[model samples]
Target: MELLLGQSETQVEYDRAGTIIKGQEVILPKRKHEDVHVNNHTSVWGLWWKDHQWAYKCCQQTIRNTYCTGSAGIEAAEAALDFIMKTY
Candidate 1:
């Protein structure tokens, strides 16, 4: 989708939407160990819920903005995508 949209030569990492979860940490969509979403369909994406907020990670980077969400996982991915896509 990004390629079709001319969103640069984005690397479509091989991963599914099961990288976000408690007691697990996924890095760069490779599941380095384990971790955090839903229908993320993103290459580099991970999410964690903490302190009433969601921790969004992408492209080997993590940002919370202290971004918060009523739900974790997918919602976190959504929030992270919003920020990462816009800022970077």
Candidate 2:
């Protein structure tokens, strides 16, 4: 699925307040445990925004690993997670 970045050329519509009026729906898939890694280190994390607040969810890795918050929002976080899952 194509992830929407809200670019000017995108087919998305925005209101005066810069909110998403209409566009493609975003669906972030769940990753299998063996499919996720961060820079060769096992990591599992999640990010979301609600009511102007940011929430993060993460699980500890039992091995030599690290959990890092290198993403901003839900989309970026999910995209990064997906890339890592697919790449490593």
- Candidate topping TM-score: 2
TM-scores, in order shown? 0.20, 0.24
lDDT of each: 0.47, 0.52
lDDT of 1 at 25: 49
**How well does candidate 2 score on lDDT at residue 34?**
49
lDDT of 2: 0.52
Which regions of candidate 1 are displaced past 4 Å? Answer: 1-71
TM-score (C-alpha) between model 2 and the true structure: 0.24
- Output the lDDT of residue 57, model 1: 45
Candidate 2, poorest ten consecutive residues by summed lDDT: 55-64
Task: Write out the backbone clash pairs for model 2.
Answer: none
**lDDT of predicted model 1:** 0.47
lDDT of 2 at 20: 82
